[model samples]
Target: MTAPTLTETLPARETARSWWGDAWLVMTRELTPTLRDPFSVVFGLVQPLVFLGLFGPLLAGSVGATVPGGDVWAWFVPGILVMTTLFGTSTTGANLLFEMQTGAHERLLVTPLARSAQLVGRAGKEMAPVVAQSLLVVLVMLPFGFAPHPLGVLAGLVLLAVFGVGVGSLSYALAIAVRQQDWMFWAVQQTLLFPLLILSGMLLPLETGPRWMQVAADANPLRYVVDAERALFAGDLASATVAWGAVAAALTAALGLVVGVRTLSRSTR
Candidate 1:
């Protein structure tokens, strides 16, 4: 047979490419703006740093006693990392909203890129900023007694990335759903954010809360994430908490991607 034409070969080549490769390509494209304005990444760390400094000391006695090894920093730092992950990823949809408003999303749709790759890439892009901020939080707290288990911290980052992907994907889906009504996006985001944060016990332990509050925390997936982070940072990799956290993160990532990919497909079509 004659050699396939370039146009004929291109579709095959793209189809042969792995999903992750497509996702990586999309992630790199999404990261270009962040690279140009590196300051934004640094700015994102400010809130977590403030929480680390201000709230950490306050948890010394009460919360400290509850933590493993009696080190409050060990407990607080991981929660801060989770907090950073949650906040950073949860708002990523606004970027998509901006793109939608400018017709950039439309331009992207006309490209050969798979729509799922677009969602995965945008969601995966949040990992870099969250990881940078996490490392900074670790270093900043290191001298102050936040001793991390090297392997555990690495695993924790993996878990955090998974969770971030889920949160970011959901945000993008939400943006697509409310594309015509911008105020609804903000309203729903804010409405859900604080409840999740508080219920997750990132800033404080939920054990001391009343029965109803404790019951609510049990249902919050974030609570498991925070617990896993704390356990992982303390070098408890094999603990049931970490396993449950992994399950929770995996489920969230799966759900978000399913919902996001579906929403994106429906919208574009």
Candidate 2:
């Protein structure tokens, strides 16, 4: 039997197709070019990979001694993953800004796809590349003695995507909201980027910081994500860090997409 049409599956009062399918369409549309471009993958990961190679080992012994597992690479991987997502996804909306200026976004807005689908799909497409970044980082670290369990490695990749989706959605929403304001983008991007990394203990342990700094880091969502990643990378699936990170991911994704959908809708109007 043939699959039911989207309209048939919905109540008679509803006319729109399935948001899931629309999302898939959008995701596939964006992901196709990425898949075809080998260099884009390398370009996206160069900074993180460089940090992993050049700067990471200087403190590897010290950081490893500080961590419970005594594995500096494992401790550091989580922060790098979060950093990877933050630095990578922060610019996703720049393309949208260009599209808006050129009236491309207005055209896309008029299409029959659901607004949620469009936003979700773009975020979804980003997942593949983000996962690829994780793999690349891990492989590069392997020769340096980082050996996370295979299942934990898989879990870490999933969390990286979750974190990426939240950040990417916010990037697109902000880009749409601040259309053509190049300075605002740079200002906010620079301000948000390093603070998140520094405050979250991606470079050092939050616990080792001053009392005020540790307290402040506790409030940063990315800290939870990095902590979760550290746990997962260390083969500790039952860690509370994992739960908190997932919660932050869920909340971030929900907030970002809601605002993004609304912004996309207003832009179209």
Name the best candidate (by TM-score). Answer: 1
- What stretches of model 2 exceed 4 Å from their correct place? 1-16, 61-64
Candidate 2, poorest ten consecutive residues by summed lDDT: 59-68
lDDT of 1 by residue, 22-97 (tens): 8899999999999999999889989998987778888895577886567788878898899899999989889889
Query: What's the CA RMSD for each of the models?
Result: 2.6, 4.7
Best by lDDT: 1
Clashes of 2: 0
Query: For model 2, how does the per-residue alpha-carbon lDDT over 1-269 read when each residue is reduced to its tens digit?
Result: 99999879988646745889899889998888787896898887888877877667876756657765677777787688788888888888887777777887788888988887999998887788889888988887888788888888898888888878888888888887777675587678888888888998888877777999888888889888888888888888987889998898778877877887777767743
TM-score of 2: 0.90
Give the TM-scores of the predictions, in the order they appear: 0.92, 0.90
What residue runs in model 1 are displaced by over 4 Å at the alpha carbon?
1-20, 61-63, 66-69
Local lDDT at 133 for model 1: 76
Clashing pairs in 1: none
